[model samples]
Target: MCGRFALFTPIPQLTNKVGAVMSERDIGPRYNVAPGTWIASIRQASEDSAPTLEEMWWGFRPSWAKGKGTQPINARVETVATNNFFKSAFAKHRCLVLADGWYEWIKNTSPKQPHYLCRQDREPLYFAAIYAKREDGRLGCAILTEPARGSSIDVHDRMPLILNDDSLESWLAPDLTDKETIRNLVGHIDADLIEHWPVSTAVNKPSEGQGDELINPL
Candidate 1:
């Protein structure tokens, strides 16, 4: 699961990559982004609107289910389509969770090792996500995760569902809500393009460090 990640890439580069416009709030770069906090995302508000950069609370709990269920941070891709709590958003509110890389732990180690995984080319990475407005009116989201692939399997049994560059626009298109059609048109970034390396354990405490040094090779 994508419990912690980073999104220090400049907003201009993020917008240019996704053909989106900037949002009103200023989101200063942060190297240690934790759940329950607002994070950047790219989404289309409606069929007539272009995609825009916006901030969404990392945890998801639909307004309708308020006070009834858990606010999940990660939604498994295999069941998100059929899950009662997530299916509505999965069908109409898909978005991209922007990041430079994410952190995962090797649970077998004495002090579980943290690894930073990102595209080999260091380009912007976008994780597939679905969002819903909370009772307070703020948008919240959950990153989609799938069985680990490639080098990611070395660190954890699951990883975020990253969308390939070619699939970005199609994934956000408001009109293409059919689950089967979406699965066919939107594909993940090749697992082979993902690379990871052991990083400083500082990432284990999301509140302890906010520097790039946390991602430095150990």
Candidate 2:
């Protein structure tokens, strides 16, 4: 599950990369984004308009949930399309959750080392996500996760569904609603494209510190 992530790329750079207009609200760099926090996401302004950046709460709560329970931060790709809690959003509210990198822990080892993972080229990463509008008129989103593939499995058994450049158009196309086609578009990024290294445990304390030093190689 993608419990924590970082998006320190300057706002201009990120908006340019995704062909989105930056929102009026200034969302400065975040080096330790946690669940329930407002995070950056890209979605269509309308069915026929260009994509735009928006900030959404990280946990998902469907309208039917009635604010009664915990909202999930991650949804399994294998079951997302069929699960009642996520199916409706998965089919119609797909979104792109922006990030520069994410953190995962190697649980099999002592002390569970935390590793920062990102594209070797340092380009921004986009995770497949689905959003829902609650009765209160608030937006919430959840990242999609799949069983680990390639080198990422060495650190954890699950990883976010990172989209490649070629798939972005289809994934974000507002008019596309075929479930089978959407499912087919879900693809795994080759693990070799990413690089990782152990980082300071300071990242574990989100309230205390969150800066470049958190991702620095230890």
Candidate 3:
């Protein structure tokens, strides 16, 4: 699960790369972004709408599920399309979550060892996501995750469903709602492009980090 991550890239540069119009200009670089917070994403208001940079609450609870117990931060890709909780959003509210990298902890270690994973070239990673209006009518999102593949499995059993750059526009294409079609059209980024390293355990406490040192090699 992608519980913690970072997005320190400047908003202008991110928007330019995403081809999205800047809608929320005041978002600053965040070096230790946590769950249950407002995070930035590129999404279209409608099928024909141009993508726009907007903020969405990181936790997801569909408006219909108000008063229900769960607000999950990550949705498993295997079930998202068929699960009632996420299917509607999966088909209509798909989005791309921008980030420089993400944090994961090695499983079963005496003292959990946190690692920072990012593209080898340091280019931004775009996570496949879906959003929905919550009980309070606020927009919230959940990152999609798949069984860990490549070296990422060494750290955790699951990782965010990151998309290849070529599939970005197709993933967000509102007209392509058929589950089979979506599955066929989108593909993940090359796992070889992802690299990870041990990082200072200061990241163990979410509130205690928001600086470059949090991600630096231990």
Question: Highest TM-score, which number?
Answer: 1
Superposition error at 184 for model 1 (Å): 0.5
Model 3: colliding residue pairs:
none
Each candidate structure's TM-score, on Cα atoms with residue i matched to residue i, is: 0.97, 0.94, 0.96
* Clashing residue pairs for model 2: none
TM-score of 2: 0.94
Model 1 Cα shift for residue 88 (angstroms):
0.8
Reference-based lDDT, residue 167, model 1: 91
Evaluate candidate 2 by giving its C-alpha RMSD to the native, one decimal.
1.5
User: Candidate 1, after superposition: displacement of residue 3 in Å?
Assistant: 0.9
Per-residue lDDT of model 2, residues 1-218, tens digit only: 89999999887776676688779999888899999889999987457788889999999998789888889999999899899999988778888999999999878766767899888889898899999997678889999998877667878889999998777767878777788997687565777898889998877778967778889999
Give per-model CA RMSD: 1.0, 1.5, 1.2
Q: Name the regions of candidate 3 deviating beyond 4 angstroms.
A: none
